[model samples]
Target: MNKEDVSFEIFPPDFVLEPYHVFRKNALANRNRTESQEVDHDMDILYQFWSHFLVRNFNAQMYNEFRSLALDDDFSTRNASTGLHRLIQFYGASLSRNSVMPDQVVRDLVDLIRDEATTRAEHVAFYLLRSAWRSGSLDPRNREKIDSVLDAHMTAELEK
Candidate 1:
């Protein structure tokens, strides 16, 4: 989670005008809204916005922040899972677009999914592994470890 670990220096002068800032603002507003008034429509839009933004921007700090928010137990499970799903999709797209995320960020994401052991987390881990394979960012040994975790998840699901 160190700021220095990720490259935020690639941002151009016009970054302030980017739609991500607008999404961020809306997402924050949604976070503070009362449960009775909150709507999934706004959350869905925010998730979509984040997915598109991350694919283009690929800032580790932003990614970490998004992941932390999504994984926070205080948030509704639906929102958290939706956020994580969008993030996993973003990671795949970003990798295919030739934008490399930091190693630590990837590792952290994988570890989080493994530790959480939810079906949604397993799906996220699968996407992460696919992205890693496509991007060639992970060493074979590490990849095997991730694959093993995914296999275990799948096995557990089948058993249930």
Candidate 2:
């Protein structure tokens, strides 16, 4: 079969390629690049790429980074603290900011869980981070409160 026929066979019978239609109409669109008509197909493609990338990579990277930062004594003196604090503040100021607790809280919990799991010779960080990450979606307020409680507990422990 020809490439076009093969493609048609692969696609659902009712399927229509929207990008092909857009490409066909691009000459007309170029004549009228109005505010809404100005299509940034490149950005759309980039967004899709990153969306897939994050979906595929975020979990593994997040766990490893959290674990590494948690166990590393120098993390507090490094990017986990001040850099992350700035990120939280910037996101908090934006109206689009959905996060209620803070990234600092997340970083603190990562450190705390890492310490507990590593020093106690228990692989608790993965469990804690996984549960906390899940709770972030299910019960955000509870997640924040839990992090706060854990932070207090860790701080008190460190004070000794």
TM-score of each: 0.53, 0.21
lDDT of 2 by residue, 1-160 (tens): 6655554776787865566336435523442342332323432332233323323344444434333322242134332232222222322222122434334445544555555555554434335445444544425563554456565555444334
Please give the clash total of every predicted structure, in order: 0, 0
Q: Write the per-residue lDDT of candidate 1 for residues 1-160, one digit (tens) a residue.
A: 7756867778874544336577677767776663532335556566676678766766677776766665562234434466666666665665445444556655665665556565343455554555566657656655554445455654344234
What are the lDDT scores of the predictions, listed in order? 0.58, 0.39
Model 1 has an lDDT value of 0.58
